[model samples]
Target: MASSTKPPPVEALKPITSVSASPPRLLPTALSLPPKWLNMYSSFITANQSSVTQIESALRSLTYIIPGRFRDAELASESLHSSIQLLSMYHDTLLTRAISKLPGMPNASLHNRYTKFWIAKSKFYRRIATMLTMIQYTELLWEMMAKRKGERVRWRIIVILELVKAVCRLCLLRITNSRPLVTPALPERETIPEEEAPTEEEEVEMEEEVTPRVKEYKMKRTGLSLPTLPNPSDISSYLLSKVLTADDIKAPNTLLNKVNGSAQLAEILHIIQPVIYAIAMSRSKDKKDWQPWLLGLSIEYAARQLRKDGLRTTALEREQWGKRGWAMGWWAMRGAFYENVTKGFLQSTSERLPSLVSGVLDDYKYLWDEYYFSTSSN
Candidate 1:
């Protein structure tokens, strides 16, 4: 006779709140804040919900914690560090570890759970993207403040900034990059095959190994430049850290084993276009074509993705993005961030930058006009 024994008891998942029992030891200072802000964050942390509700609460609190102009460098830095630490913990526990254990298709209930989990994960990534952008702005603010104050800032700020960069790495690592808005987690090319399908285990394993990492920074230094002539690497590092550090450029692609399609890479270039232009204008005589190469290689990859997924078929994809118009806004935002940063930094660059950037802005507006009208009429 067949056995009637039940399967082993399933273990309960750990609470998301419990995942980060303590703040990071390396944080510049403990995450203390003014009484009011501390109270707000305390309430957010104690809440029992495990979904986007907590995310919303944290966002609201974060807005207040990050001051309008970043005064009280120590306090602001601590608050930002604390807030990101909590957000990162929430990401690791609720989305990365817990939700992934749910069953996939076969069972309707479990399948729905998995689908919802993915949606939640995607939303969380969007939030992280905003926070990531804000962190870059914080770095900018620090530089501006130091310049205005005419004194070197504290070393504590450096500790905090480095930690925040680490946080960027962590956020990128834990999230999915199969689409845009969700930055690509790695920097390698991807290829998908029509035949010899991967097993579920294999797919899971591959996704876990996902990486299209951002490694574009030229130096490790930060804040106002010293009076001494800075090295070339310093300039590259300063430029990259001012806005984005390859987050938008990084994509994890499976089609043809690459993450960036040409448009997607173009999207990255477009975002970094300002930086490339700045670097080029600063060193116009250096004729190396990596920036264009970056765009060209991505173009080739995009073609491969298109040919593999659409070219052989009768149905053409209407999406202009790397995948089904998924990352369109995010890709656009990368360009926007570059524009915003470049425009601001112009005060320190070539005197003509202001006019040049304004012209670029006009061209951007015109280019997007067609996209806007076309999409709206559709």
Candidate 2:
């Protein structure tokens, strides 16, 4: 009996508790992939990469279409103009159609698709540069003819004026539409009303008293966030005015000696205001954020248009100036919104967090150098 009893006390398999084999080690869930369309679009941008060469070709091809070019006589002025008008219309229509069809709040895939479509469309309209050049040229011709009453023909001038208007519209549309959606910000405006009347003694007293109070209030309330979608109509109006009225497009450095004394200030202001608005809108939470990327794009585009003579500064200088303008704009925006731009830049690109603060400061410094030194030197 004693021998038969405790047969090695059979190690009581204590209910095998600790998840027998660690609960079947779960394999990681695969990340959800972007749709196929998006992959295709990204591949397209990579394949048909934009470069200085494409930009140069775009500008040169368009220059060929200019009305008064040295070798443009193969076609009649009317014929060339018609050809340009048709090409412009076609490209404009294509862009408009593509934009209208784009889905809102598109995922990364959709963004890639849109980008690819735009790049491809841009290639198709390598002729646009010519159209814009011609438009600018036509406007100049019309203005010159206006000054020379002896050279003006009423009917022909009417036709040319219409063409100019048409071209200007196209230019405005292209610029405004080409811009990816920007975030919206508050327009500059006066919140307080001025009194219609005040006594001389009271005015002096009010100036001393009310001015400080108002200034303090303004300083306190100076900053604000912007909206996402600005009215495209508003941007169009601003762009149209600049394209038609820029003195460089009308005549050259003659305005350098004029009333304001800044040769391109008006044009700069015109371009800057909308660009600022675009940046604000790009920072908006509701839409796809594009301000930072758009800033980079705008700077690159400006660089493409610039060239150097024997001057110490080159087109790179101009591009650098554009970036400086962007940095200044962001600095102003921080003040305008009553929020810190550095903080905003940090928050915007937070996923790339480690270098965020220093990066913005570096950008600010680089831009300042470009604006104050390079642009002035050029």
Candidate 3:
């Protein structure tokens, strides 16, 4: 029988009440605030306390609901549902208000007061994706316990179909609502800036004056300064650590296989279209040529695999999820945790950080191993 259950009512969920957009700056010990100002600050907190409580409750509800559908699923398990619930709730209540009302927020900053909350939606999608993975696990367990012939297969197909629909809506909602708004672009190059073009006479004169000797020397020196193509090692461990590692690190081997399957791989690829574009663009001096290659490679890989495996193909079908995985990977490399980027031990926290993180993770691991060995000897 088909699963009659609907996808969770993501849209129907109530929003948290807005909080004060501008929080007061910390008072210096010597500069006592006037009695009236102190009273006003106290009153603001008191008024918003109830609203904060409600947002927390809502997030708690979301976390509770995640595993409730599966009789076997545990509420306290090491899954992303907990992180999503806590983070989203905090974001929806505290961060959202600040972003909407706070003045002097840094522009184009992802972690600035305006941008931090955007991570909430993306994190929500990650949890939802993880929960869908658990659903697959439950189905497999059901199949193993099935005594009647064909019972497992019928139910598995039904559950898989439902999951497909739920995932589609989940992705649509996430992209639409994401903070910093994840926008997808079709494969195309932007037109060159008009000002970059020079007159024919000027171009000819410049070409003649710029001797082959100077050109060769410039090229040689520039090559040394330019960065090399990124290898896997180039990705900092600190960057990787940003990917919210759920308490549930123990994905069943079966789940891992499913994740790596052709269908699943394709799905992830489609969801991460933005990241794919970014990666390809980052690689090239010109954005136009590389983007087409990136898009084409993902599409072709999925299409060919689908054809080879004879997976169902239809007009309504979206490519299976390697796109989302790519996005997740990018986030793992670039996203931050609770640590604010505004302050650091030394240097503006916003500065180029990937290399710094890479060095730290490398040294830390070696140090840890040395400590373990010394302790064991004692």
Candidate 4:
């Protein structure tokens, strides 16, 4: 009886449309705008990185100007500074990735190997550097929380954070094999647009030019092709070649030679200076104790002098060191020096200055009085 029932005619049978067969529902404008805006912002940052950096720098400078006249002003300034730092970190991350994808110089030289190694190493170190920066920006917030608990807790937190930073730096030093650590950890790569990249024709021409020179070099050599010689095809051995060692891969040297042991000691001193200060502050009964200042300043000054003697720093390095020296002036706002000398000097100076200038000084003085770390330039 069932067989006798004829199958439904093909024309009568309608195809069943599953729910998924329908086109995807468009996201609401409000829901979609955030991602779109974020993409646009990211693109803008990528395109005009230098300008963005300048803006960030300017904002940071403004934070310094926006004195801690009241609790609200101090909070605002700190928030602004931290936001800028975070934004810079984000931009730097994007730039790092962009630089990573860029093609190496279109030449068969040791430079290609060096670029490859540096990019990879820089990627690893950049993460550590970013972590250190994160710790720095969040320090105030952490201290604020710890202060609610106890003074000792706050100081301990500082010590711990500083120790972590020092340990991370030590790790970086080891990674560099005692070489000078670059500030950003990521080396700056020249941004080459697609049009700027070498064309196939150019690459062919380069190969032609390079081949003859290499052949001539081989011909000039008196000895047999030694097994000890690096195979150009082997990346590890190629990088380890006399012309391009691991040290060269890690960072550039302004001078011809590698940094001496004293330079390494200087780096160590720089890394541990904050930790020494934190420990001293934690142990000291007097906030204006001279011992902490003496220890911290002595170590810092020695480090600076040793750095100068041991290595020929680049202009940028010298500038950074100079900033550290300027920061040392902050010590006058702390310790017995501040109590005995700087406080009275500032008071007298303010009295003689114009009202506006005196007001500004008073604001800064209040900040210095209220916060232990307010004078920290970094």
Candidate 5:
């Protein structure tokens, strides 16, 4: 006891009550990982990639098939037409098939990109094809017979524009499938009794009020006979008619009489009405929407085709001054649409967005500067 007392006092350990230890830190629970959608995405990319390669090949084949020199002397007219059309059909079928293989909406943004690429690329081909056949290009024009140094027995670049028409309809189809609830049900028609029908005098007077004779072309299709997807002619007459707008439809035809193409106005509706309806349906509940911008692009595409110096436009374009009013209207819509696209593209992070925006503007440059401006008043 004495020895223990004599020993130097070591520092005493803290009492259990005084000693404090921190609680052990917990490592976060391992997060569950999301499923990789690699396989599905791979299929989509592969389909598009293969299609691109095929398009390139088709272009090359056409270059070979179409003689480099516009040899009116050597080539037979019937044979040349046969070759051009046959090759065209082959290429068209391939492209359509390729486009059809594209994966749909699961990764819709990507799907839209490829589909849009096909549309633009198809247009580029049209420009080239048209250039080949125009009067301006001395090299591209071949003789139909000895006397005529005309372009080949051509339907406008029927192949490419047909593809565009397909895409427009496809877009409309998508809009329909979007199933927006905005479309109002058809209002029930109030049928007048036979006794209450308009008098012969009134009917005669009403008929007399009509000034210009309009030949109406009603486009009809059979549902039972409807071909498999990417049908040749969904918007068959898009290139044939002017782009219809919301304002055009809302106003009574009496007011629209000033425009020459009033008879064809329904054609405009047939083409654009479905598109507008689709846009309304496809837009999200959120305030921000791109439907108008999308429509602007459509307006530009349709109107540009109308003005193009190619087969499609060449066939449809007439010298009538009245027909021009619709072109001007399309221009206004295009300007508005371009503004929206410009804004959206500026804000977009996607790599392809800028190019698509610029590509459209670049292709249409001569349109605004040389064509539209020259046409517009000072």
Candidate 6:
């Protein structure tokens, strides 16, 4: 019989690995987690955002329903609105980190690459602008409260806030090199946080998905390495190359060839108009002086026209413009215009209406007269 040597023991049959063999590639095991407390807070706030919004809306509507006789209720509603806004601002601070972690386009086209590069470059200023806006809005609420408190320093505070905002916009303009400022500065991220950490199986799936590409990338450079043209689809290499370095990404160029000088000017004027109004108010003896109204309205009208002429107004800009237009109706309440024009019109209209409708109109009129800041554009 052939000496059938039993197959080598299973352990001995195993192939020997070289001592210098490359270490196993480490794969990311899980998605990054924010601080536990922050995760919980953000998760709670984000999950209830819609409910909060609904509650706010209810509060606002309550102000309309509550008669002027209930002054405390009206003030309470206003306070709650301001409190909710402060909470929203706090949420915004946490949002920035989430936004930073978002993945970039790995296979961006030339135009996309340029856009991404500038956006990344301007990220800091954009964040500053966002913070300033939050402060401005929050301060406005406090300023209204301060006015009620008979604080002599409120005017100075308003002037300083407006000036600071103007300066921030100027810096933004300089950074963009006169490019149209993106309103809101940052895009909205998901309000809802992740409900659960990824499961082990999901993590393994993600590892499997990512590992092959990494291995392929290594395999491509394994042998006969040579200087080859950078792939246009490879965003990392493109970013590292001289192309982005040589070009001025922030140069005054139309975004998608749609923006124009008119848009830029409109944005600038829109930003500074509040400052102009604040200055006029500070100098004037009468808070509702026609001079300030004329000055503010003129600047605003010019901005609106320039924006219209640009033919490149975003939906958001258009919406804001519409809001400004509505706010202009409030101008009738300012200066002698309300005493001479609007007051008579309202009186006549209310006289003709039924008692119930007239009562509602009177409540609204009370809101208009008693709480000027409620409808103020600034």
lDDT of each: 0.40, 0.37, 0.37, 0.67, 0.36, 0.61
- Runs in model 2 with CA error above 4 Å? 1-78, 102-378
Better of 1 and 5 by lDDT: 1
Please give, for residues 141-214, the per-residue lDDT of candidate 2 as tens digits: 34333434532342244344444434543443354342211111001111122235877998788777743321
Q: Write the per-residue lDDT of candidate 5 for residues 38-157, one digit (tens) a residue.
A: 445444544455454466457545534433234442235334434554444334344444444655412222222223333344554333333322221121222223224322222122
The 10-residue segment of model 1 with minimum total lDDT is 369-378
Deviation (Å) of 279 in candidate 1: 4.6
| Number of the top-ranking candidate, with TM-score as the measure | 4
> Could you give candidate 6's per-residue lDDT for residues 131-197 as a string of tens digits?
6667655664656566676645667777777788788777766766665444444443334343579
Q: CA shift at 327, candidate 4, in angstroms?
A: 4.2
RMSD in Å for model 5:
29.1
Badly placed stretches (over 4 Å) of model 1 are 1-52, 55-82, 104-274, 277-378
Give the TM-score of each candidate.
Answer: 0.28, 0.19, 0.22, 0.62, 0.19, 0.55
Name the lDDT of candidate 2: 0.37
Candidate 2: Cα lDDT at 252: 19
TM-score-superior candidate, 5 or 6: 6
Cα deviation of 33 in candidate 4 (Å)?
8.9
lDDT of 4 by residue, 214-275 (tens): 23224346755434444557967666443644333443333122456787789889888888
Q: Rank the candidates by lDDT, best first.
A: 4, 6, 1, 2, 3, 5
The parts of candidate 3 lying over 4 Å away from their true place are: 1-75, 79-87, 90-93, 109-300, 303-378
Q: What's the TM for model 5?
A: 0.19
lDDT tens string, model 3, 1-378? Answer: 897988778655645444326655576533665766755754453346555446656755654333233433432331444454434333333333444454543332211211232234356544544444444324323332331346444344434434453464346444433211122211111111123489899989988895553222234655654433334775787456446432123221111112234545444444444334334433444322434344635563563355323343221112223333343332212212111231132234324568656444433333222111111100
Rank by TM-score, descending? Answer: 4, 6, 1, 3, 2, 5
- Give the residue spans of candidate 5 off by over 4 A: 1-85, 94-378
lDDT of 1 by residue, 80-191 (tens): 6455654554433433333235444122222233223344557775565545555543553454344444423422343354455445535543453522222222111111
Displacement of residue 308 (Cα, Å) in model 4 is 7.0
Pick out the ten consecutive residues of candidate 4 with the lowest summed lDDT: 106-115
**Cα-based RMSD of candidate 1:** 27.9
Q: Which of the predicted structures, 1 or 3, would earn the higher lDDT when compared with the native?
A: 1
Error of 5 at 363 (Å): 24
